[model samples]
Target: MSHGVNNVRSRWTLPDYKPTQKYENAYRVTARFLLWVEKTKNRKVVDKLDAALRDGTYQPEMWVKLTGLTVDQLWKEYGDDPALALTYK
Candidate 1:
């Protein structure tokens, strides 16, 4: 979050540049989720699904059904890549 805020602050310091509240919020959310995914060693599909849930704009239960990962296991074994995780499926 600090990284994201610093990034926006740096940009704002530029002359004639103004950052919108909406843009900052969106980027902050994205950066935080990306940090979570990367540190968890999770892949794009799961990360996208997680982001969708965190944004609260969609119900991830349907995605869980399709992807075959319960919310608990999703967060637990996120260290594994999708293909490796799928092998145990």
Candidate 2:
């Protein structure tokens, strides 16, 4: 995946590097999810998951247990991009 860009010396070399359209779309979707998290506030469910992840105690079942929501539902609330529908599972 490095594709020789990891140690490139100059910013001009950046333009020579490009991901495929598939990767570009994936990046955009991930960015959208990140932006949603950044913009959202006072989300108690996400906060709990974040804390669990940071503390190394996160469990897949917690998605339903704590939030009373499926992973897909949480993702929908976060961004709900169609491209991300298959992302949760």
Candidate 3:
């Protein structure tokens, strides 16, 4: 995701940016779950997440409220699904 973000930055002539990768795996898992949510529960969930994040009000409970799934449940359901893998073209 940071890779993609950097690509966008380069396209816009912004400075090259590198976000920390210490939580890459966590980011990937959360991304997969979000993809699942967008696929099965709410098509605008990513947008909602972005909005909440931008407002500094994002919370894990938001996922529960949106899909009735806890973080653990989301992981169990979508963690190993290759179809939801985060990919950059």
Candidate 4:
């Protein structure tokens, strides 16, 4: 009977979320892609992709092929929509 708080029994706890390898991989891929574009691709390429993302018509197949990730994975990393963001690791 030396407990500090015994008012009531509860099962509540704070969430301790951590990003998995998939998330790290996605982040790295996106960072590298952006850096590559910044170095080689012009602003127009980024602008076009931004427009496509806004319109929900973005297809990152070429990026996937180069990054060795699936379209779904790229989308999870680079998708503009919140719904798609929620699909991330």
lDDT of 4: 0.42
Per-residue lDDT tens digits for candidate 3, residues 1-89, read 32255544455321211232211356554454566667777888889879999999999899788778865665555544435434342
* TM-score against truth, every candidate: 0.26, 0.37, 0.53, 0.32
What is candidate 4's lDDT per residue for 1-89, written digit by digit as tens? 12123323443221222233232455444443444343343435556667778999888664443455554554454333222111111
Q: Candidate 1 — which residues are off by over 4 angstroms?
A: 1-57, 79-89
Clashes of 1: 0
Alpha carbon lDDT at 74, candidate 1: 48
Angstrom error of the Cα, residue 23, model 2: value is: 15
> Per-residue lDDT tens digits of candidate 1, residues 1-89?
13323545455321211222221345543343334444444446556766778888667474465456544554344333322111110
Best by lDDT: 3
What are the runs in model 2 whose C-alpha is more than 4 Å off? 1-42, 76-89
Q: What lDDT score is found at residue 30 in candidate 3?
A: 49
lDDT of 3: 0.59
- Which 10-residue span in candidate 1 carries the lowest summed lDDT? 80-89
How big is the positional error of residue 48 in model 3, measured in Å on the Cα after superposition?
0.6
| Candidate 3 accuracy as TM-score | 0.53
Can you list the residue pairs that collide in candidate 4? none
